[model samples]
Target: MKWLVPSAFMAVLGVTIAHSLVWGALICPFFIFAWVRYRPSMKIIAICVGVCAIFMALTSVALSGHESHLTGEEQRLPLRLAQPFKIKGQTATTTATTVKGESILVKVYLQDEHIPQLIASNSPAWCYWKGELERPSTARNPHSFNYRTYLWNQNTHWIFTLSNADDFTQCQPIQLTIREKLDQIRQQGMNHLKVVFPEKLQPIAKSLLFGDRSDIEGELLESYQQLGVIHLLAISGMHVGLMVGLLWWCLLRIGLTKEKVRIVILVLMPLYAIMTGASPPVVRAVSVVMAVIACTMIVKRITLIQALCLSIIVQLMINPVLLLHVGFQLSYAISLSLVLSAARILSAKSWLESVFIVTVVAQLGALPILLWHFHEVSFMAFVTNLLYIPIFTLFLLPSLFLLYLFSFFLPNVTFLLAGMLEKSVLLLDTFSMFLSTFPFATVVFGKPSHVLSFFYIIALFYMFSRWESRAPFKAIIFLLIVLCFDWFSSRFNPFGSVLFIDVGQGDSILIDLPWGNGTYLIDTGGAVQFGPQENQFSVGKDIVWPVLKARGITAVDAVILTHGDWDHIGGTLDLIDYIEIGEVWISPSSYEKETMEELVMKLQNKFIPVQEKLAPFSWAAGNAYFELLYPHDRDYEGNDDSLVIWAKFGGLTWLFTGDVEEKGEQELLSRYSLKSDVLKVGHHGSHTSTSQEFLTKVSPTYAIISAGVNNRYNHPHPEVTQRITEQGAVMLGTYSHGAIEYRFRGDKGTFQWMIP
Candidate 1:
């Protein structure tokens, strides 16, 4: 009945309305009814509902504006939103600002292209053209010599390209800023930390402070996740909460009055938040905490639920788009669950009881949301959190504080603290690494439909909330029914077919079976480590994990390394500790001894079996059959050591060649007869592999090339493509098409094509 609770409920309802509007007509009657029922005396509720209607109208106007701007016969508007632009005949001084993945924002100065005029005219807003075209002789020919390309959105600054008109047309240079001072300081810090800390600890410190994760490495990151201590690395609500609590405790210790202490805490929290860039989740937490404190002091009788609702409403008011953000949703949901479930948990006496209660409640509240957003659930997550939560609270947090506190005044003390923290992190990392290696430690469920996910959540809620009288029994029955449905339905799930994931110039294929038990992964996509600026380690953590989790696959039967090329094996180290990996197969001759030795040690510690070059190995699950084809003796170099695999199901055959070049191709030709229904083109369709003879022999109906867009190497070379075409092969490329899928129908043969 309270205003705040209704307001929060309305805000949530608003998001549902927005989503519904995208698919069907908005229902105005519900809003009017809610307004009349919830706030009989308030006119503002009607006004708010009116404003929402106005916003919806504006959204439609925006969509119409976009449609009106489009040319006839155009399926999609060709607008270049955020492209690097340069003017001809100018010595442009450029500087790079923020570097994210492979993209960096480079500010440039150029001649002939009037910057103020371009901004005023908004000519550069949706058009991306290199400074090569001579200024149009007449206004009528706006695109005569110019290439007027359209882009998806116009939200970023236009980067200027500087060169002669001719040269600039073909190539644009993105300048990198030299952060000499910061680099020197970071280098000094790294050197100092390396001397005092263990090899693994330095990366953690770098990641914790500067968001620089290049040194963290995949293996260590996975270990932290397996140990359930990954949250310790990122500056999250837990970290901010500890900071706030610590500051409050310190102020109280200094004999500050409660009122004064609260004021100081209020002022300091925002400052800390700002320093950390105040990401959405962090800001949400800060706002919620502040709202709770303010209500306690001023309102005197506000319930926690009311305060939480107010927090959500205020946040939504600030950024309505937050409703669509996954992090924002998870943060609020987790916090609300903690607040709602804490009283019940507090009644428990045993430490284990408290841990289990908290874990179960949190997971239960988060399960539906997690499963809704991500298809997979971590079965071992509860156990992992139970073990690592204490370590994170006691060891990691304290050590970080001590390290920072002593860093300036007592440098030696900081080093000592770092050393101690490093040892603890290593121990935790090692433990997680070992646990993750356990067979079936995690379970994967491929993504489910939104409707199914909704039902699953509803079922879980009914069971947990005791809306039904026999709560426990009903909950068990519901779970059993869901499991039974899943088991029965999985037999016909279309995603059971093999998927060649579009990982951008890298090999990563997922093989799903109808029985819910089969091999899941082939290779993990990875990029080369050229420098600190060009690392994709975090991409693997953020993007890859979410995709895998969405599909409900937590463990891969085997992670095929293929070879030691950075692209093939880069994400392997990360996967080993986060997902349950049964075994790792690689070519003995592909990797350097030192790298191989390190991997072997980690694998041995985790008790994961390692198989190298043991030829003609076969694995069968459900209706699918897998066989290892190449690396006879593992006495080869580079592409020759590539692991070639053959898979068959219901008269369909697929082959995966791991970056094998001409030498490997000739070797394969000499040794074996190649034939497949579908072929994963080797080395991204490099001319060196996929030789004419090989193509002729394989006679594949479909060929998939995993390549990046506009890569420097110009992969899937014209000549190689011509060869595949001549062989009557339908070549599907990841860069052009997103992900390629192949499904085998017993009598009809293989159905292969790109999925959206």
Candidate 2:
């Protein structure tokens, strides 16, 4: 009963944190009242208060330390904005500088920027502007200097970065001659070694070695997610634990004493964590495991739960922001659940029984949290875990150890071990794919509200706790209630309408009709001209698919790609592969030699029809009507050839104009009298499009802009925003609101705006 009070309060606190609030204001009073009314004892109260005070103090200290490292110049507002400039230079060297209590680093670059019109009256300023002794000259002039001062908010438009003497320091020039030699080796590896490896093996190699995933396609990532095997991609406690165990075994076999083996494992685990980038979650996991090991050797007793809690306290004290990180939350929550629940499961003598118990307990504990965050439940996760956990822990982890150990001395052994691991991975992948293809293996429910999610979690907890008791009946009833609520909630979907998803600096729109009649997806959000190597499909998988699944959208009637531009169609390939698309529509002019063409070929092999710009054909689903409005034969360039669309439901009208520029906008205005209740801004509201004249012609009451936050191009430019505002139109953007919806009330002759 005493534990329930704190547990309930902590659950509320967790909900508040997920909402991005600084504190749970509404729930804090309850916690305070509990603390006072319970009146456990002076000693217990003092200890709890002392712990909280220490935590707050530590957070304040960390934040203050971070602030002190910033330059005085950065603290002040800019006197003037400098013109955008590009510099050509390479990273010479980097060294971490400890300032106050925070880590600040200075990067030395041989840069070439024009002499400033106004220079600061400081010694370093002159040295920097004149390229003096403080400034080292390199092969390339005007090199860019990028250094980490503090964590930049990816969500903010204008981030303050450190400048001037407070945080900056000059370092010795690094020679480029050595860099040239390293470049040659990198090029050789890319040109030859990359070609020799099979395409499917690349993701495993990247995940195991560098933790990079630029090469893994989005569809495969979704497959892994559906198979409940995404944890394999991330370097987690399981991987580290396996490594430690392998190291201990090897040391003991080679004649090391028990104490020596423990010491070696402790030292080697941290080293491996560092090599893997030492993300906050990984660091916390390693620290907790190490502390447990230490306690076993020295103190002779310590509860795993206590060790985990202590590790969390240590991590939170170091960086309170980590408490807000999703990965940190998931890792700790899942691990803690296992620690608490695994003991309750009946102990078994057989190895298979032990494995089954562990798998079931962990999966049961993690399922609620997983479903709450992702709205996905893999029915085959238990079996998948049973099959892969042992393989991953025993075979793959040992292979990694062997590869690292024999790489230099017995180079051939590394390749042989890698080959075996690759083959094993291929086998596991095939099994996962087969399981994924099974009917009802994966279920996706739309996003659940906090209250519903809480109840669902309670139901799961109840079910797991009383699986072998009569209480299981109560759990089933609770689940049925949840299902009924979900069904009713889903009934309120804005069907037979077009929705502009707010996926900042990108475009993703959804069109839904009643009775599962017609579902159409316009452009999946993606960058057009930036980070060319980044696949839009991966973004679609991580961002779009989850949203769609949550909304109970499993199939699309038509995936209308406006053009071949990355922003317009980058995610189309991945979406086509993951979801059932009846047909694909694109502008004929978009047949450029790009990833889109490769996507078309893939779809063609699957017997999915791809249609180029057809005449303004009308399509109907119940009372809703849709018609293509542009991309006639006269249009040539991909941008101008965007598939303009008009949709009408009841009295409501919506228009979707792809990234058409001023010329296209003017042509549309000249050609047609476009009137709509809602409009999706063209070219992301760039100056090149969305002319006032065009907006006047459209006469839309609500305008939606799909763009990213703090985009490089500054999308939805100020002037464009001003123009929309001037028209007395309600402007909604994805950058601010994740996804926007509109529901038409036919009887009232009005519509409602919604954000989910």
lDDT of 1 by residue, 226-344 (tens): 44345556666677677778888998999999888878877766655554545566777677667667766675777767767877776666555566566677777776777765364
Q: TM-score of model 1 relative to the true fold? A: 0.64
Candidates' C-alpha lDDT: 0.61, 0.62
Model 1 misplaced regions, further than 4 Å: 16-218, 232-262, 296-300, 342-346, 350-352, 372-441, 467-471, 480-495, 503-513, 516-529, 532-703, 706-714, 723-729, 744-756
Candidate number with greatest lDDT = 2
Return the lDDT, model 1, position 184: 36
- What is the TM-score (0 to 1) of candidate 2? 0.68
TM-score of each: 0.64, 0.68
C-alpha RMSD for every candidate:
10.8, 9.6
What C-alpha lDDT does candidate 1 achieve relative to the native structure?
Answer: 0.61
User: What does candidate 2's lDDT look like per residue over 1-756, in tens digits?
Assistant: 133223323543544443344344534554576678777776666555555555556555544443433342333331111111111122222222222322222233423231221112112110121111111211110011111211321111123322333322332222233333343343333333244344556566556544444456555666777877677777788777766776788899999998888888787666656556566667867887788888889865656676776677666655665655667767876776677663445467888777777766666666656765666677677677777777776777566545645655765666666676678778877776777777666766656666666666666666666764535678767777885676445534444455676545667788776656668899887633322233432556555665677665677888888877777676776565457889988887576647678778888998899988754677877677888888767445867788898888757788899888788888777777898888898988888889889988888898888877678898888988999999989998766554566644441244333332
